[model samples]
Target: MLKDENFIAQNDDLDQFNRKRPQFGGRFLNDESEIFQYNAWDDVEWNDEQKFLAQEKIQKNCSKLMPEEDSELLENRAEFFWDEFYATHKDGFFKDRNWLFTEFPELKRFSCSSSEEKCQNFQILEVGCGVGNTIFPILEAN
Candidate 1:
């Protein structure tokens, strides 16, 4: 029937629209029952109740005060703590972030290929490199 054909056409149009829409990733939370199944969900829209509860929690925590001495002590000992952490881990704690190439395509762009000459002038100052996890991968790539 013509009605059936029109319905199919409308569905095709909807499918095309959905295809054209930007996809953050394939791991979407399509079902409420599967919410607890994943550690993280991509492009999730929170319900009003969830949003309200999050706002409530944020408001409750916003007014909490830390002792000035405790804050100062932590700030003063931050470098010593970081040094201790680095000494303890010794570059074994963090995983090499291979996702950096996908996340930052510029890393790939700036990198020289095996056929190309290696760059001596490429200077990167990575703040908080944290045991060369980021810089090591960059070095390997470049």
Candidate 2:
């Protein structure tokens, strides 16, 4: 019963609504659930294979700045250094690097405003942001 333009507009609205739906990825918490099922942090320990895969990813990503030997050392030392660094600086160590908006176009989809608007508002929260590395990169890219 709808006109062609109206059907197209309704489909577009439905698509937008589907895109905006929030997704939850964890198991439900309950007394009947197994310990591993309830506790994501405890259940998510990395095995040797996973660690090796991560090491491979690091090697590939940072091949320019890190030789294999130095990369291994850097990866090992990163956890300790990050913890210590954040302990001293806490929230003050990072400056908001919002200039990255020009570099990463994918982030534009997260903007609340229309695409025509030059300034798009976005809220990005980084869980386990680890000395703001991810946060800084995203902020810089935005």
Candidate 3:
């Protein structure tokens, strides 16, 4: 969302593509948000009892669907839960995940420079019922 404010006319390079729809292309960059990317790398100061209690809580929440008792039912239950969630929210949950480029370089490499190569260059494996917020922005940036 940055703009030239110094009254400078910059010739933005336009990338052209040929297709029924156009692809979104932009340079990945960061500004202002990352105040400090460095970490001190210190270990957590949790006691043995506290650590055990935290693990128990995580395990309880993770296995709330009775995964150990019935694996098939757990899978179906998770899918149904996500389906209901998306059915309730719809596109309200979908958003532009421009940060994906920073973590996953392959997404940019897979993105086609030309619209003619759209959907023909790579494979996108959609898991669960996500609203395509992560993939669509990288593929359809205008």
The TM-scores of all predictions, comma-separated, are: 0.55, 0.23, 0.37
Q: Model 3 compared with the native: what TM-score?
A: 0.37
Residue 15, candidate 1: Cα error in Å is 28
lDDT of 3 by residue, 1-142 (tens): 2333211111111121222212323222243354354222123367999999999999999876654658776676988887888899886776654445444544544433344555445567868555655766455432
Q: How accurate locally is residue 1 in candidate 3, as Cα lDDT from 0 to 100?
A: 25
- Prediction 1 global C-alpha lDDT: 0.63
lDDT, candidate 1, 2-115, per-residue tens: 544544554455446445543335568778898797666667788999999999999999889788999998899999988998899887787664355444545544533333
Question: Between which residue pairs do clashes occur in model 1?
Answer: none
Better of 2 and 3 by TM-score: 3
User: Relative to the unseen true structure, what is the C-alpha lDDT of residue 120 in candidate 1, on a scale of 0 to 100?
Assistant: 49
For candidate 2, lDDT tens digit of each residue in 30-111? Answer: 5554656533322355799999999999989877665789879878899998889889988886766433333343543442
lDDT of 3 at 75: 72
lDDT of 2: 0.54
**Clashing residue pair totals per candidate (backbone < 3 A):** 0, 7, 3
Full ranking by TM-score: 1, 3, 2
List CA RMSD, all candidates: 15.0, 16.4, 11.5
